[model samples]
Target: MKSDHSIPGTEEAPELSYRILSDTSSSAPVIVFFTSAVVWLLVGTVFGLIASFKFNFPDWLGNIPALTFGRVRPAHLNSVIYGWASLGIAGLYVWLTARLCQTEVHWRRLLYISAILWNAGVLYGVVSILGGHSQGIEWLEFPKGAQTLIAMASVLLSLSILRTFYGRRVKHIYVSLWYILASVIWFPILYVIANLPFYSGVTQAAVNWWYAHNILTVWVTPAGLAAAYYFIPKVIGRPIHSYYLSLLGFWSFALFYNWNGIHHLIGGPLPTWLISVSIVASVLMFIPVITVAINHHLTMVGHFGKLRYSPTLRFVVFGAMCYTAVSFQGSIQALRSFNEITHFTHYTVGHAHLGLYAFFTMSIFGAIYYIMPRLTKWEWPYPVLIKFHFWLVALGITLYVISMTVGGFIQGLYMNDPSRPFMDSVQVTKPYLMARSIAGVVILIGHLFFIYLFYLMIKRKGVKRLTPPWYEKAEEYAR
Candidate 1:
């Protein structure tokens, strides 16, 4: 990666002590992890579109058992969450670990084996759910056998990361490493505890939401934030505004987020005190959200112009903004008053997408744009495709989220009104549901384009441009 201290009169140069992109042993697993993730992304997109279409055209699949909305929806969710985001996060973990530790991966073969086992577990889980073997939990729908495989894979990966960290060449660990390492620790514990089959009835429901919510907060959100922390500074050619602030954000998140997941049970049959505690925890999460927002946005204070020249900057900043928006919105949604309107409505669906797609998934996309080129030693085949992928998915998700939000609001209001027939809400929401279908199509197109571009880069078929697109000095180009 190139550095630019374009800001004049900077007495000390930004730190370039980190090593990156030269560790083929580490890069190999990243490639496999990411490539498998893209395949799952495409599969998840198709399943998501089918689910959207079923909202409007229920007979489109003629009542096939596997194609039913109930089954396909969970299949889509599991596929994207486990198959796509999990794999992408694994890839990010590998790269971040190697770079920060300043060492080649110690157990490269184990990472390779873990990647394969991880994908296999996710595949089996998705298939089992569609095959009616689901464990009937929301996020832990995967059967115990598949869950065991995933747990084992996580254990192996986590051990590899810890070993790398122990051998780190740098004395002072960056804040991003804190997040990356924390996620590795948090996920396996959450996974094993949540997937244990001992609980039933109300307890099971509580455990289910606990796993689902924390999977997002502890696992997915941390990976995305880690990437934003690294890439934002790397692309902007600056250190974070405050390392102390970043540490504060990480500790606050670790402390509050574990208690926050229970808020998803706001109106359910859970104890009032538990619910109140969760509400407070959710609200406390804002402290960290604000800290992160300030750290990232403040670091980019004068480098907003770099977005024009850096694809990674654009994707990451967009994701960082979404993280702030989604976290704030989530805190509000956890409130009893706000949950009264949004709970059990499509509004919740839209909110989930806001977190998963706009925040976490987009962050991974940005990291890929930055990491893949270095790993493959080839630039993206077409800068235009990069632009296309960005705009298409951006527009698609915006439309998708907005339509569901407006439709859900209308649905909730109608549901609350005594005089309105229940079907009235459905009638009014029909248009928005259709709009979601359209948006899904647009997003699918973007996925296809991204997959093609990824294939080209992996094949190393692009022109030999060492720098990112639009990254050239006028003098050098003229020569």
Candidate 2:
């Protein structure tokens, strides 16, 4: 595919010139964020595998405090969420904001500082969690000092991004920018409020869920969605199927997602109206989900064949489809009846992976696959390895989610039946837990391949590409 970076109908010389300038300006900070994110991805994967295996071999590491399931599981979560996902998103924000804005990134030095502080915060928080210094809140388990560092890093990063956005030369902002802009603005406020020391008791629980859910909505989800919006059409060489639909999707998502988190508190001691409103918002999520699905799907209806050659398109389209599936599943999950069955079960675990790993992580993977080459000006060294990485993670997540959902449903059924002993629930989930462990192993192998490929690309060990890798013959479709 031709590397056309101009807006449709606005493919002027200045736009093309600015695209090159933007890439050059954003390259260093982008690479730093991605490199840090990959390191964390490896760390998180190891932690996750340990956590998964402990279910089947509970005593294997039972003697080690840091290796125990409690510490390992949360460590896995924080590593991936704060470290891998957040860092990757930061890199994408730097690149995408510059590209969309038609300007070089601003305050480049601050972005480098932000990267350092972010990594330091994650490192300190992970150590503190393993050392039993956890704050005990779900997502905010990071100690106060660690949270402060992350919050400060986020502010610095936001300053750079907002400054770039302000300096944009474009007459019209793109859809991706809207999400990027919203996320940077929303996250620091959410992070700071959630980390405040005063919340306790039931109020703490409420704030915990609020922050847990909103972090995904306002931070990660927007970045993931922005990637899908940008990469899908960019790779396919077409504009999005519907710009108005994209706006509708964005606004509705912003309106409904914040409220949907309270649905996690359905069975808790929260106020009836609070839970009721959350349920309503969750159900209303269908509006945005459907609109996004239509926009992405219709955009790719005829370009499915491109997935054969473009690793970026394959991962992104997979992620976009999963975004639809997971969002719909989330809407169903918020209902009182479904939540009753799946609330505390491994089904929720399956659901979270479907959204986070399958949707968001894969989207980031696709973005990196596309963005890294442009920044580094190197082709992927091993096409076969890319294929292997894709199938491994794809099949791995499929098995993982299937086993957890099916097993957790049975486990839930057993628990709900008072006639059956609680042990029955535990016993029934063993096989599925084993399946999840196997899946983790597969995904870990994929990450290893990806990390190697990334290293090769960064070191410029690969053959230089004369053109972008389009599946089959390169065909330039109209923007």
* lDDT to native, each model: 0.85, 0.91
Q: Write the per-residue lDDT of candidate 2 for residues 1-479, one digit (tens) a residue.
A: 23244433334355665676687678889999999999999999999999999999999978988888999888999999999999999999999999999888899999999999999999999999999988888888999999999999999999999999998888789999999999999999999998878877888888899899999899989999999999999999999999999999999999999988788888899888988998999999999999999999999998899999899999999999999999999999999988888888999999999999999999999999999977877789989999999999999999999999999999988989999999999999999999999999999999999999999998999787564333112122211
Best by TM-score: 2
Q: For candidate 2, what is the TM-score?
A: 0.95
| Stretches of model 1 off by over 4 angstroms after superposition | 1-22, 465-479
Q: Please give each candidate's TM-score.
A: 0.93, 0.95
Model 1 C-alpha lDDT per residue in residues 1-479, reported as the tens digit of each score: 22332212222332322333224446788999999999999999999999999989989896688888888988999999989999999999988888887655667777888888899998999899889888777888888888988999988889888888886766789888999899999899999998776999888877888778999877899999999999999998899999999989999999998888788888899889988998999999899999999999899999999999988888899999999999999899899898887777899899999999999988999999999877766788889999999999989999998998899988888888879998897898899999999999999999888999999988888776464332233212212
Clashing residue pair totals per candidate (backbone < 3 A): 0, 0
Worst 10 residues of 1 by lDDT: 5-14
lDDT (Cα) of model 1:
0.85
**How many angstroms is residue 219 displaced in model 2 relative to the true structure, after the best TM-score fit?**
0.7
